[model samples]
Target: MIQAFVEGGWAMWPLLVFGMVTIGAAGRFAHRPQLAQLRFIGAMSLLTFVTTFHATWLAISAVLSYLSKLEDVASDQLVKILFTGLMESTRAGGLGGLLLIVTLLLVAIGTLRLTPKQG
Candidate 1:
């Protein structure tokens, strides 16, 4: 988990904070359902989605920049480098996706709890 965060670079920090706040709010909503908390969770999820892609793009750009500087690099080595960079880049997206899923589940539970028992 810590390794992933380090490989994910700066983008992961904001996402970490967003995820924590969102999960906390969602959990709170579940305990005491509130419209405001639901809205906050929704907004945080959206932000998380955007940041995930943004981090990926940054990583890709870095990889491209690094590749551009190379001269006469072997195909096998180039492929290895590309693969490694792409894999590292995906860490941010993976974390964001996990956070989104958890937040959504919490929101759903909160919604279910918020609604009165239909008779």
Candidate 2:
């Protein structure tokens, strides 16, 4: 995994940093709920999703590479399996990341909406 990231070049570094910051911000938000921190958490969650784009692409590529070599595999079967695996992986990571971002945004918005304006 480290080797893969190293080979992934400049893009991976920001991804790693974003992932770490997201994890840290999430942890802090869990420990303390404050409207001021919500924006940071939401931003970090979005950044994490962006950072993970490569993983999703790689998953699709892997599915394609594996299915391409299998002469016996039917087209429909291949498409079905590919989409199934892609959805599973995406839920585990891609969609899950988006869900986190949405959840954070909603929470932040709700909090702001409920808070009384200060004069």
Candidate 3:
């Protein structure tokens, strides 16, 4: 797990930061459901999703660039290398996505609290 994170390069660190902030905001919103918290959660959710894909694509691009630099590599070996890098790169996005899902669930719960009670 740690190795996969390390393989994600510098992008993982920022994604981690964003994910943590989003989770914190979402948790707060779940507890209180304030207008300001709602707005912040919405924005943070979007930011987290964008950062997730950005990190994923960045890692994929790096893999492709590295593959291009190789000369006369075996076909099977190349495939292995490509997949390994891709799998490693996806770790950041996967973690971000998991965080986003959790935060969204919290946001949904918070929204439920916003609905007026009826007899």
TM-scores for all candidates?
0.90, 0.47, 0.88
* Tens digit of per-residue lDDT, candidate 2, span 2-94: 444443444445556676676666655555556676678778777677657765566567667777788887889988987865654343253
Clashes of 1: 0
lDDT of 2 at 75: 82
RMSD of each: 2.5, 7.1, 2.7
Model 3 lDDT per residue over 21-84, tens place: 9999989878877666777787888888899899999999999999999999999999999999
- lDDT per model, in order? 0.84, 0.60, 0.87
C-alpha displacement of 67 in model 1, angstroms?
A: 1.1
Q: Candidate 1 or 2, higher TM-score?
A: 1
Deviation in Å, model 2, residue 105 alpha carbon: 4.9
Clashing pairs in 2: none
Residue 10 of model 2: what lDDT? 47
lDDT of 1 by residue, 30-115 (tens): 78887767677888778888888888888788888898899899999999999998899899888988988888888889888886
**lDDT order of candidates, top first:** 3, 1, 2
Q: Which ten residues in a row have the lowest lDDT in candidate 2?
A: 88-97
